[model samples]
Target: MANNSDIKRRDFVKTAGAVGAAAAAAARIQGAPAIQKVKAANNQVQYGMIGTGGRGQYLLRHLNSIDGGRCLAVCDIYRPNLEAAIKTSKDKPKGYLDYRELLARTDIDAVLIAVPLYLHFPITRDALLAGKHVFCEKSLVFKPEEVHALRALASSRPKQVLQVGLQRRYSKFYQTAKQMIEKGMLGNVTHVYAQWHRNPGWRMRQSPDPKRQREWNWRLFREFSGGLTAELASHQIDVATWMFGAEPEFVVGVGSLDTMKDGRDVYDNIQLIFNYPGGRKLMYSAISTNKHLSLFQGTRTEFGEVIMGTEGTIEITVGTDDEPAIGLWFYEPGPPKVEKAAGVKEKPVIAGATLATTGRGQIGLPILFERDLVTGKESFLARELKYARLWLYKRGIMVPEEDRNPVDVELDEFFQCCRTGARPKADLQVGLADSTAVILSNLAMDEGRRVYFSEIEKMGRTPEAKGRKA
Candidate 1:
């Protein structure tokens, strides 16, 4: 929670513990006590991939787009996905029906395990034991036991890196927001509200074979996925955890699978409340109905968190690249506009003068501040400064944002971490914590009772790290 001005080139590295120690020790040997080195990869790391499904293909695209390491091979149980992976690979990375065979490759320095939630632990466990760094997707482990075990394995191999695919952790805008939050922009944030509403779940592939239907539409099942909670809610919950500067102590919720009567076991609408120890709460919701909440321009059903604070509120959404990261802020009714009754009214100045609507004088904006928006403008700094400086900005300047993908940034950061042997922002602990939220929340909804985060089996630690943010 350091201020922006205090953050140096390597300041971010200091935020992590074990990896930061190694980095700091290395810097010390060079007669300088740098805070720590960003746990970015040194470009010598080579990556192997497992699972070439659509998600896996997306990772492949990111791998090919950025440099840190190249994919030497990919593995999948399915033939079509393997074939697609081969075509996707620039080096025409070797394909294997068995992930074990791919892990055996000598050239592979790290592995990107992109399998479903059920397969996450075994694949990741095997990769870690193979002495390969791991970049697994979110909900790093499905059950409580895997969380304990994987964390222990990671601890045993302290030198190796393990990162979760919570992309926002690597985003520049999100990081900037974190910095802003730490700097007291929100003045003791109080409550957060978020929602993710979509239509008919995801389009299920037309399937004759039951196995085919299950494999392709894993998201719709309970045994395979936690529906939107693990698949979608995890991201926003992570944002809540980040912005609140702590993890929730407990969760309570109500959910029903009223819509999408398409034999999907997962709920269609879920409303959850996470309770932080500081008396703060995050009210979160997700529904697979009409994707219409008017947040993030309706591209997404759930726009973002409405971070309420003493000073003001911020709306944030880490959304599609075609649009951009969305955010806007409203200053709390500035000190109650006072009206002076000077001439003949015989009355003194009064506090309440002008009234406003709930979300007034705020602008919806692209968070990235893209290059095209900066062109023809003198300076981005000027635009930002001018808008913020005004008492009331009559001519609001547009914030520029990238029309391209944010996964690019997320992947690049992962590679950098792998090469440098540094801990990623979304390291093992962050992923597990987010997963904890999911598991506990689901429990809360199912049981019709409040579920404390502590109620779920805590991962890794034999004796809990009680009271500290999970």
Candidate 2:
């Protein structure tokens, strides 16, 4: 018998081979649309960036590669952030201290917002009212009222695009996963387990100036942040809800501020279970003490999700700045079917070779190809080639990857939508639903109760409801 270490080594080699082959094969794939360059003036969307903080700067780095949009203006309350944005950009953009000033420009057709959680609503609302298309970062709104408010505002501005910065929605790997789920590839996904464990947690920096301190450590305070839920868990929870194809009915959870004591009120650790329709559940955990992820056999860390079904399981995660997103599937093994002789009684055998013959751990199948690529419409040669590649993929000779990073794809799509008035994949409705989950999930932990997602319908009706926070 092979040792576990030896088996793992073999599995690793196969996985590596499959990934490399798939990546190489994807480049030469026929029938794929040619990559178009965004050099024409009519093809480009004029945009401004607001709140050029860490997240904002991160987006700017990605924006460097994208040409479909041009940054006409940059805004940040902090002078350094504004300067950094100006320096990072290829096109010279006017700098503003107030975001409203940036929004006032008529030349700017859209805005990319990467502000703190609390400011997400006010900024987005203001930008929409300014008649510019908006692409705001994730956990779209800060509070319940914002959810209702933004929805109403976005509905009124049907001409303008409002896209949320949930890059996974634009990822090919994720889209393929969604298609697989729809096609029963995973066989009735019943449960999803997600975790985002980070070491050291959010930095607790205190400035001599009170306002600066608050601005610097907004993530640590409960008033401005939803802690781990809004920052990390929201992404994974959205993935769960998306893959399940339904909203969660209710959520129950607990949160604790035990680990890092730095005068911050938000919890350092959290665990929640979302009960969706059809008896499906999404179990989640976020902790500050560790950064180890159990998915992909500990190959990746910090964040990932496990989708479990009757026939198989899928472990998936989106790409970071350094790592590309990956998805792997493992099929469940059942007892072998045996045919009995007609009218003959089966007897128990004293000696059994079943244990010796049975396979140990199952090898993971890469969730790679698009449904249409291997479907009925393609030419026989194309279909044959796809199947042959699939055969290689299953044998761990090739694994698939997206042609471009999701972040870049998302930004480019946002720009295109802004110009063409096309609806985005991660539009306002999806953003609002994700925000509602974040708000209610935090409330579930805070109030020590199982909170229904439907509560958001009536949540912001009154002043008291409007002021509710995590």
Candidate 3:
């Protein structure tokens, strides 16, 4: 196993020699494309932001690097959060206590929503109705009705851009992986396994007041949050569906509040299986116990996905504050082909060997997606250097990474779309489908039965109707 120093050194060498002679060769061979620069109509897309909480502030930090959009206003129900937004904003955006007031602003061309899950629909609906292009965070809609309503509403506003916050869609690593899958690099993908675990998960916010406690700890309550499913599983589920090229047919799961007695109704551990057509499946788990991750040789912790196929498997995860995103592939080691007599019955190969026993001592190949630019175009030397780096990567001596973080790219693209009327990759349909998965996965755990994905078509149909009480 590689040590921390080994990991750091790998990242360092890759970073230090990211681009040189070999890069140019590969680009020349691969047709290196020029980067697209968004031309803003009036310098920048003037936008307002609502729900200036932790997520809202985190996005604002990334937005600082994006020049295509300018924040003109911010809104939050909490005074402190509104103040925090103003502090985070580079343009010194005006702050409002009520989101409605921010939506009424005429100067803003779009709105970025980072509010709580329950409030995502209402604020987004209002933002669209107010004639602003909207950028909403993931788990787009809380309820099934919100899914239908938002679909209809967003479709009606064709001129407006509605981008969701599934930033992995904007990642070059993920894009390259998808391309490989399409090109049959990973033949006949049959299963995807995903997990997001945390130690001492979801720390309850301290508040003396009852109302404030509920509001602060919304993620732990059924009415205001979707718990682990919406908060964590939603992202991975989207990844699984994207890789599989289909929505799940049904979901069945078990969840319980086995630990963490912190006045919360949400479960502390969950295990779910999503069945797709053609016998494909996605197995997902989220636990609030240990943070030990099962991928990347345990180099990373908390969250990741393993996509399995007949030819190979890819283990991938999105980046976080301190860790760069990574994707590693491993080829399957199947038995050698042999001719059999006609009508002869074949026994199962290695029937006693389970995943636990068979999934060891395999080498992982890092997926290289970044390109190098020497002066302007590709060079033969750069291409050579690229191959050299790949050799180091295969030996676990170095690892390659995306040149730019996807979060910033996704945010930048939102502003670019606002300027050029371009459609976002993570648009309305993708967001709603992801939300639908979250809704159903939670329902499966709650009802203790299999929940069909189609059931979402009927859920939340009645006005003011609620799902099962936690």
Model 3, position 175, has a per-residue lDDT of 88
Worst 10 residues of 2 by lDDT: 1-10
Candidate 2, residues 173-209: lDDT per residue as tens digits? 7888888888887788999999989898787876645
Can you write out model 3's per-residue Cα lDDT over 1-470, one digit (the tens) per residue? 11212112123224323332343355458753222222345668888888788999999988888878888898776677778989998989988765666766677888999988987877777677666889999889898888877887788678788999998898887887888799898899999999999998998888645546886788999988899999999988998888888999999999999889988999999999999999999999999999999799889999998989999999999888688888998888776678998999997878656765555668788886746222345577876787688778889898877878899999988887877788999999899999999999888998999999888877766544433221
Point out where model 1 deviates above 4 Å.
1-42, 296-302, 334-397, 402-404, 458-470
Q: Scored by CA lDDT, what does every candidate get?
A: 0.71, 0.81, 0.82
Relative to the true structure, candidate 3 reaches a TM of: 0.84
Instruction: Give per-model TM-scores.
Output: 0.78, 0.83, 0.84
2 against 3, candidate with superior lDDT: 3
After superposition, candidate 2 runs with Cα above 4 Å error? 1-40, 206-211, 338-359, 371-398, 463-470
> lDDT order of candidates, best first?
3, 2, 1
**After superposition, which runs of candidate 3 have C-alpha atoms over 4 Å from their true positions?**
1-42, 208-210, 338-360, 370-378, 462-470
Tens-digit lDDT track of model 1 for 1-470: 11223222122223222333443365457642221222334544577788788889988876786756677788776677788998998868877776656666666777888887877877777666666778899888887767777776688777778888898776556765676577787688889888877766576676545546765677888877887789889988998898888999989899997757777788878999999978999999888776667554454554566788897677776756456666666566556576776685665755663444334455543333332223447577766654563423223444444444668776777777766676788888899899888888888899999888876655444554433424
RMSD of each: 11.3, 15.0, 14.3
